[model samples]
Target: MRIALLSYSTKPRGGVVHTLALAEALAAAGQDVTVWTLGRGGDAGFFRPVDPAVRLRIVPFPDGPAGESVGERILRSIATLREHFDGTGYDIVHAQDCISANAVDSCVRTVHHIDHFTTPELAACHERALTTPYAHVCVSATVADELAAGWGLKAEVIPNGVAYERFADTDPAARDRWRRRLGRYVLTVGGIEPRKGSLDLLEAYALLRERLPGLQLVIAGGETLFDYRDYRTRWETRAAELRVRPLVLGEVPDDDLPALVAAAGAFAFPSVREGFGLAAMEALAAGVPLTVRDLPVLREVFGPAARYAATPEALAAELAAALTGDDPTRRTAGRTLAARHTWAEAARRHLAFYRCLG
Candidate 1:
């Protein structure tokens, strides 16, 4: 089968990662797959190197006019991608996010998560992306349920596949490097965005420090198309008020991420919204104890393999518990769960779904 997968940017966002991985897996399954994305900031390739089997078409997307609003940028992104993309001759055109879905005339969209945007242009874009797609996919059943409830759309649920072995078998020396550099710390990814519940995590980190004064909070990865400067400023102000210092390591190298996950004392995921907790799952693969927001999607995905919390106080308590002891059973369960989700299996299922659509 001939397939074309589209994503908005070449940055290391969840959807872009999914697009590249899925494309490679499809190619490995003896299918013709090509990935299409905008090379934002003159990026000629992905954050990490992609497999050679899958072809790439990275359209050069320059930065927009100075002082453009987020809503205006979204519209421009859609327009730019639409102008460069050619959906002809492909049996399937798959869009991985709202921008890509809006770019193509028709596509099979993977709705990673549903966002409630307040901006007029953003709200309309979100609506059109959900309503206009020919078919829909979601990474978790909870998100699919949300789609059904909000738009009366039935979607196929395809859970994300983790790089199980890569994380599970991290080099001890590399892990030692991270530990030597950062000491014992709680880690979170995805930056200081509102949806990531950054403020809540800051409060939780402050509370955790009362019990373990030496423990650090290390944050990594903050690449995104949307601007969150205001939210970040608020987070910084609150951190100052609480008298806590956090190490914000923006965008760790992809090659070093597994070892960083393995070295962490505990991983904290306080996102208010998520389709699937991929980073948390990676932590699980690395045998790192995890504490995440008590959301239905997380509960469904992690089950008994992780600790859950709803508030900052509860989150601090859970992190304390996670750091205090070693739960071999939970670690084993987490590794087993992570191992069960493989890219090969995901590719097989995707092929079946594509065939059914035909």
Candidate 2:
């Protein structure tokens, strides 16, 4: 089966990671896979190389002032993509975001979030683009439910998977480095975005500081996706005002993430909205016990393996307990659960989906 996977901009973000991994997996399963993405800015080395088995096609889309409205840019890119895919034959064309408007015989669109419903123009564009018959894959039931209720679109739930071997390997140097700075630290991985609940984590850390003097918080990942610099600055100032120490490691490389997770005492994710929390799963796979907020998708993925904390105070209390408590049983359970969600299984599911389209 020849499959064309479409994503306008395939950067090294979570969505791109999912698209690339699935493409590689499908190729490994004896299916011909091609990735279609927009050309990278001046630096071609920005994106990691795709697998040798998978072909890559870059369609040049117009670039203008970064200050231009996103809606206008999206419409322009969609028009360009439609022109590019005019005669390209594919068994299945899988579009990643709501903006991709490429027409194909059998199309599968993955909805990570519903941006269109929030804005009138985007909602109209989304409705127009998605009116064509296409199978929809939602990363979480929450997203699917929201789409069904708001947009009246039906979607299937297919959770994201991680490469187990990547996190399973432990780097002694990383552990030693973290141990040197060590106090009991709660680790949070993601961009400092409102939806990610970074400010909430800061608040929770502030509450934890009074009780635990030696407690530290390490936040990994860079700036917010939507250019919320003011929000991030406010959090930084708030952390200082509360006298809480935060180690902000911005935009870590992929190879370094597993090591960071392995060195942490516990993983903390207080995100309010997420299609799927791959960072939490990676931490779990690395044998770090998780303490996440009560979200449906996370609850379904982590099950009884994780400690649930509702409020900031509750989160702090839970973090303190998890860090101080020695629970090999909990760690074992988390690892066992993480083992079930591997990229190979995700690959097989995608292959089967593609075969069905054929």
Reference-based lDDT, residue 254, model 1? 95
- Scored by lDDT, model 1 comes in at 0.93
How do the predictions measure up, each by TM-score?
0.99, 0.88
lDDT of 2 by residue, 95-127 (tens): 876556433444788887665345555566677
Clashes of 2: 0
Give the TM-score comparing model 1 with the true structure, all chains together: 0.99
The RMSD (Cα, Å) of candidate 2 is 2.8
